[model samples]
Target: MTAGMPAEKSMNFGPSARRLLARLSPQRGQVLAVAALAVLSVACTVIGPKILGRATDVIFTGLLGKQFPAGMTHDQAVAAVRASGNANVADMLARMDVVPGRGIDFTALRNVLLVVLALYVVASLLMWLQGYLLNGVVQATILRLRADVEDKLNRLPLPYFDGQPRGELLSRVTNDIDNISQTLSQTLSQLLTSLLSVIGVLTMMFVISPLLAVVALVAIPLSVLVTRLIAKRSQRQFVAQWTHTGALNGQIEEAYTGHELVKVFGRQQEVQAAFAAKNEELFRASFGAQFVSGIIMPSMMFIGNLSYVAIAVVGGLRVASGAMSLGDVQAFIQYSRQFTQPLTQVASMANLLQSGVASAERVFAVLDAAEQSPEPARPARVTDRHGRVEFEHVSFRYQPDKPLIEDLSLVADPGHTVAIVGPTGAGKTTLVNLVMRFYELDAGRITLDGVDITTMRRDELRGEIGMVLQDTWLFGGTIRDNIAYGNPNATEEQILAAARATFVDRFVRSLPDGYDTVIDEEGSNVSAGERQLITIARAFLADPSLLILDEATSSVDTRTEVLLQRAMAALREDRTSFVIAHRLSTIRDADLILVMEQGRIVEQGTHQELLAAGGAYARLYHAQFSAAAVDLDEAAAAGAGQVPAGVGPRAGGPRPRIPAS
Candidate 1:
């Protein structure tokens, strides 16, 4: 399986190809119409050479039948069929045309030429019509394909994204889709035209002269053999090329998006080196595939020219024996060339189709990814007005083999603040993810207001909870638009009130454009604290019954934090809230405090009670206080220019001091 391939590996080339064709179901009528036009185009083109051959025969007969000044016709005028072991039947036959010019039939020859030209013009028009219709069908199919991909993205589980790079997925959506479009527009039409051309040319060759047709037919197997050999080798390279291109895309997205981190870590050279290596691999693979496929046209052309020469030699002998006409030999040579033309075209298209298939495989892989299991039949529906949440013996893991949360249980009472305090990697965010149904529980169940959450729709459960994470997300839009995202129908008054509550209005009013100031995609125009404030304002506007604050205030300054705390306190008046914080001071006044270590709750109680118990919470609280005191003392000592014993600027650092503050 390729990197980023979906778990459903059973969907092979046949199935993926079938799935792609299925997209054309709605446009079947249009497809048939285009095909009919293509066939007509081929028919007209095939008959043109035969009609031109008739004109050649007319002119040849005219020259031969005309009486010369010697009173002998052109045929009787040439006494010898061969001279000096040289085969120039045409030269020998035309030797008596000195005075036959007056008897030549220009009127009949003109009529045949006009018919040939008319057929060619009609063929060209039909081809253009076919292309115009096929283009519409191709675009319609692409539109549906895009819609399917977007729908698939919405249905896929969050863990699927967690394991795949955004750039790779983006490539599947943009690059892969574009590949399919190009293939449909260019390759498919060419394929149909080429196949029809080959068939039509073959029939014409045999009609003109079977002996020469045999020579022309020989080029088919040779062309096919060459195409097969090159396609086998180039197919693998094309697949690799697309895969590497996707990988390069991923690397570029990561490096450029996190350019600040790269600069800060001084890894500019490393990023460039990594990109260069990936790009080099892509280039080599792309060049190999293209070079191999490129040999087809020239190789087929050589075989085509050889066939033409063989036909001319054989047909000249037959014509001298009175078994063939000059026009027939001429048509046979033309047919031989036309026959190999489509063969070479099909060979080239074969290579192009291989690249398209590789892209299609990646696209199908995403569409085939395991989606979140279907919502249960007759799923229970419940409202979380009471805001009571419970986890009953819940166990979960991102990877099934490596358990993260095991047999954990907890309950948050209605209208109470439950502060979950844990060290990093203690599964703080996982708890929130479980409640949001972002990841389904491996064992046991969670409930909202005494109803099993699993029985309810995931959207329903998530709708009741508002979340503000440590990393704030804001799209490229005005401040008012960002806040209104959570509540699109929010009135101007409601929008202003939410912004005011989170102190977002303070900064917004200062800006020249105020609420209408547009931010970029990364929201780089604003400070981190300001972005966090905007997210908070968004949540406030949502007014979800249950609120989750996962280090929501970590980015703000002390003054902003104080204001945010006051704002949250007001919002939490009659709602159930879960606050996950590293700063114990932020959640010190919670109605319930759950001290966690690893993935289990080691201690739970009111803040003062836990402190009196001198457990993990008490130790954590004292450590923070001691760190604050040491910082203050160190600043004062620096001003006084004196070192405290075993504490300030010592070779060994002092242990965290437990001040009485």
Candidate 2:
């Protein structure tokens, strides 16, 4: 269930590779243009060597003709060489179309050279155009892929985010996608050009001299063997490299996020040790992948050299025997080089392709994940927002085998304050979360104003409620901006009113920037109490019909809590509110008090009525007051110059308490 975790199973290269290429399908027109250009470029390049070979023939024939006796016909030159007992030279002379007593024909040579130069120029221009178009195609494909991933993130359920490490998920979205872009940018055009060159060059080699062409073919099997061996080994390393990269990023992010806690707990060494281990793993993986794939190019070149040596030796014998002309031999050698060069290029590109595909697989896994259930096609509307919430036989569990809440039911009537008090893991927070639809119930349904919450659009249901949690969240923005986040269209007067109502304005005026004060990235510039007040102010601005406060006053001082209580009482005038708190004094005035134990309401009544019943609520009420009484007694004794045994002045004073209502 952990997101972006490396799969324990081996990578399926074929399917993933095919899927990666399939992403290019939308750019079919651009791809086709690139391919056509590649074909034309390769064709021009292929023909260049043959045309130059003709120029070589013109020069060679003219040079040899000058060595013959002046006025001697081509037939006489061959006959004279035969009579001179040089039969090999006679055969060579017979094959060559040489004019006796003639020197290098500069004009013909110049004209052939011009044609070769023109072919090369046209080929270069076409190749450049091909590269430009291919770049656009690749960029467009990656752009679509990035958009898809971003959309997928929004559709994912909360549980998906809960299970995923932030850094690992970021690595998948940002790092993995970037890797794919680089891979395509480096390989696509080169791969196409190399493939086309191979085909064109091979065809020309065969046409010029089939025997030498056959010799060059010997390198193909050897090259394939080398490439396959290296690519197979490197591919696993590439997968490992990216996997470890994600793991290392997760570790680093976790470490940095909790850096303050690490120092406070003196666990810096432990965190560093863990980081080093993951870093080492990533290093080893990257090195192995690079080193293995690095072998392909040199190994291919070695195989090509072997083929080149064989072709050269054989072509020389054929030329000397007059089975092939000097010009054809020269052209065949050039074609052989062209053929092996592309093969080597292809072999070298295997590793890059594999690395890119590895990243593509990771990105695709995110896109392929299961999303939250679709919203209702015909969503039900809550016409009257009275804020009456009812849980009808609701059952839920984080795990299938271990139920947390089963068949639990409750109702919070409009304009009433419902306070829930419980021990840890008693499902106090879970109750409010269900109301907000953060999670789906396993059975039964929650209704808002007599309408099933499931039938309403999630956003529409949440829009009617406001929430404040124990862990305050403040982004890096001015105080005014943070407050306005609750209601984006709130006027300046409303923002100031909410801030003053929640006691935020009192502190804001004391700061140099007042309401314009900027919160840092961590919001560490503000005290915990100040941050909590800001969140409360934000909720106030929302002015929702239903409010859920989870330990909203836990971080504030006793005086501030008392002030906030008065502010909240006024705010809750015509709205329903669910307040989860451990402080019994804060909830003594609630219209209904629910004492929950093990996900069931063990006691339900007004605070004083529950106390009269002397059940779970009574025990919880007494437990909190008893602890505070004990601390107060100790502090009182110390003030009277009578310190308890083994106690010192630094033992601290009585804990802050909210006055009983």
Candidate 3:
């Protein structure tokens, strides 16, 4: 979602500026020192022109008497002087202040140049030092921002991820952070330097000639107006660019990740169209932002050039009419250019600054996000499986005012495998999601070992509940890593042991790398059956007091299914487990099979007991295995009978033959 437009969204430059300043906290001393040196440099810059102007004026008024040669006639000297009266003339002149019969006093002018040059050197050195310090601050700030963003991502509730694309999250963390970095590392300090220089130049202009300075500065406000207009247009476009970039990245991720499905469906053209649309959106936004910001610099230069012409024409006429000295006009032109330089700097840098701000806004939007339903202050370190679970009159809704499970109650004793079978959207997942404390309950309580789950720390509650979701997702790491994900502290020996318990050893030990072989994200590189086994191994490694297997065998072939079934039976030994599945046949061995409808358990009992009762459970069981052929295939697969390949395990497909009944 785009950032909300609150009533307070108006540009408050003061706070943003303050935030920028605060990031330079530790280096403020260096900034101040550099600023002082820069001021000295500006002082020298203004004074040098005045000194040169004074020298020219003094020479024009004959303030410097001729150190003319004695042989020179008055007429010859007068002719030379008349020709040199033009300000553009550069004829050699002798100083009036020279000691007679000695030498010209060149020391004053030399010292003036030396002082100015020294100030420039000092200023340059200060600027370099500032560059280093500010960069260090910028890098440090970005690192902190990234770290904080990551921590937030980790802590946010599971539902948060369910609603957002992974690619968008990646963009926020990586691309957005890079934007802030580029702005800080390059444009930020330059803007500051230009702004400071502009201020100093303006002050100098006022001191030298206020009236002329005002005329030169007329362009400053005009350029700022143009910059603001351009910036407003570019700002909207930059926001759009980043948003579309994220969407495009998400589409690409989905495409590559789902390439097999896409090709199988022959939806290449469909995917191409979607991608093209997203890419075009991104391209247009980027181009528009760039084009608008690009126009700012040229506009600024136009205004600057116009200002320069105005100052030259006006000041030159004053000089020609004896209202100002030629030297004064020269100094005035320099000051006029100085006035526009800062405006140009602001225009050039505004684009970078806006991007950084937009990025920060996104980043802060995450940081400012509501915390993952707060955890317990001091959660118990729950290790022992007094796995007596109870959902005492619990109620919940994913959305407010739209309750899913209401006033529902259920219980499972320790070491019992509870199979909960329900139709789609009957609150099966919601019940478990609440039990895991992924989402808070609206009413009532769920307890494990007589302690309410909400009162315990989320990590502590989840730590003991090993989960195998219907759609298994593994990380980009080794087999060992995936197995040990549920409990990272698991020893290598323990991981192997867990793998063995889950039948993972059957496939894993045969692999070229065994436990060392890496798996892609969501186990994309591995066979579906193997991935299921890996997750089962994860549960085994966790050795949790409670286990949740949601459609654990639904995605696997019958061959793997048999192995998983055996492993499931083994895993149920001496632990509380919740089995959620639509394939009701597989959960026949559960200690308690619950037939749920509309978030309420209509029937629950042992297989034979439920069958004898001829209730909802019995009806479901019969509905599932009503066919004689289905019974024969299942029975044959379980070793009591045999079925030929053409007959299949279910309707249509052929099934592998086994022994006859």
Top candidate by TM-score: 2
Residue lDDT tens for model 2, 481-590? 99999999999999999999999999999999899999976789899999999999999999898999999999999999999999998999778999999988899999
lDDT of 3 by residue, 378-475 (tens): 77665567567899999887888666787888889887889898778888887788889888888999999888898898877888788889888988
Each prediction's TM-score versus the true structure = 0.90, 0.92, 0.84
lDDT of 1 by residue, 541-581 (tens): 99888899999999999899988888888888768899999
Error of 1 at 347 (Å): 0.8
After aligning candidate 2 to the native by TM-score, how far in Å is the CA of 510 from where it should be?
Answer: 3.2
lDDT of each: 0.83, 0.89, 0.75
Task: List candidate 2 segments past 4 Å from native.
Answer: 1-8, 628-661
Q: What is the descending lDDT order?
A: 2, 1, 3
Alpha-carbon RMSD to native, per candidate:
4.4, 4.2, 6.5
Runs in model 3 lying further than 4 Å from the true structure? 1-114, 321-328, 380-384, 568-570, 626-661
Q: Which candidate has the top score in lDDT?
A: 2
Assess candidate 1 and give its TM-score to the true structure: 0.90
Task: Show the colliding residue pairs in model 3.
Answer: 64-96, 65-96, 636-641, 648-655
